[model samples]
Target: MKEGPDIAQLGALIGDPARANMLTALMAGGALTASKLAAEAGVTVQTASSHLKKLESADLLIQRKQGRHRYFALADDDVGALLETMMGLAARRGLTRTRTGPKDPALRKARVCYNHLAGELGVALYDGLLASAMLDEVDGEPVLTEAGRERMMQFGIDLAALETQRRPLCRSCLDWSARRTHLAGSLGQTLLSRFESLGWARREAASRVVHFTERGETELLATFCRQDQNSHGNRSQRIMRDT
Candidate 1:
């Protein structure tokens, strides 16, 4: 007899059209009420509640209570990653849904992946960090370099505080749209927060799209691209001296 984790069960749960819609709606990285999700799924509130319960039972969704209201969100980043990978595969195979919304272009440019950024901007950030030696590949995962730590601190990211968290400091997640890697894990989330705090970008309501002002994009490119050029040159000089 074969023995392994049951992928079939999970697939079945996600395969239902209504449930899929509900799950996709939660991908925006916000906890939503059942009524809101029901509208997204085009289902009745009672039906949405039942579907939510099933997802919660399957450990795909988590329930949060605030005051007198209950909201739902993706259980964790793993679930979000899996869904994004699936979407990427389907898109590549030409299995896209018939209708594309006006927000499609914006979504492909910059959108949220669970909490961190995903899309063209996301891939650019990952490449920038790698090219700059701010992040290094270690055992197939991203590890913050000494230079990365110092740079992040300069940007007001509290690396000391981040180290205290249970989650990993850095990770690389595959980008569905760009077919590249994007930063994930706690550090990724913190960076997104920093962008918002700086008034450089904001998440659109009812969507995963991250809208960056013209000034914001300019500042972002200035910060990251310059790091790439400077860090690479500095590292090369260090290597020459050591040799």
Candidate 2:
């Protein structure tokens, strides 16, 4: 007998096709009713209820009561992160869905992963910060430097408020479409919300795709890419001095 935690149990709960679909729908970072989830999984409401019960039992989901309705969402950011990582691995192995259409490109370019950004734009944001010395990967985790905090403040992010949260302020979430890392954690959530607040981007209805207007995309590039160029120039000068 394996003298440790039973991963098989959790695996089985998430392995079912119906359950997997339902969980995927919840990855939108919002609560969904059993009936809506049922539609997503192509199952009946009764069946979805059963699957929801199993997921809730495993602590993979949370059931919330609002008025007379019961809604379900991923238990926490951890569950969402795990699902994103699974998708990334599946993409790496070529285990992707065959249905491709116009929206596919948009999804690959900019999409939301739970509470944070993912896809091409998301990876760019991560890379931009790293190059600018606003973020660092230390001891296998992403950390925000002092200058990073100041930069975030300039971007209208409240660092002090973020520090008060129980959740991590910075985390790296693997992106499935881009096959790279993006920001996660509370700070990541704040950035996404801020973008929406500023009308820079908006999440599509019934979809994970994020649409950025021309102005929004311009602003995003102007804000992050300027720093990227400086970082590149600095590195080139250092190499010239050495060689």
* Highest-lDDT candidate: 1
TM-score of 2: 0.92
Q: How many residue pairs clash (N, CA or C atoms closer than 3 angstroms) in each of the candidate models, in the order given?
A: 0, 0
Off by over 4 Å in 1: 227-243
Per residue, candidate 2 scores C-alpha lDDT tens digits across 32-130 of: 999999999999999999999999998999999999999999998899999999998999999988888898888888888888877777777777777
lDDT of 2: 0.84
lDDT of 1 by residue, 1-243 (tens): 778999989999999999999999988899999999999999999999999999999999999999999999999988988888888888889888999889988888889998998887777777778777788998999999999898899999999998999888998888878776788999999998899899999999889999988887777656763553465445423322331
Least accurate 10 contiguous residues by lDDT in model 2: 234-243
- Where does candidate 2 stray beyond 4 Å? 228-243
Every candidate's CA RMSD: 6.2, 5.1
lDDT measured at residue 176 in model 1 versus the true structure, 0 to 100: 79
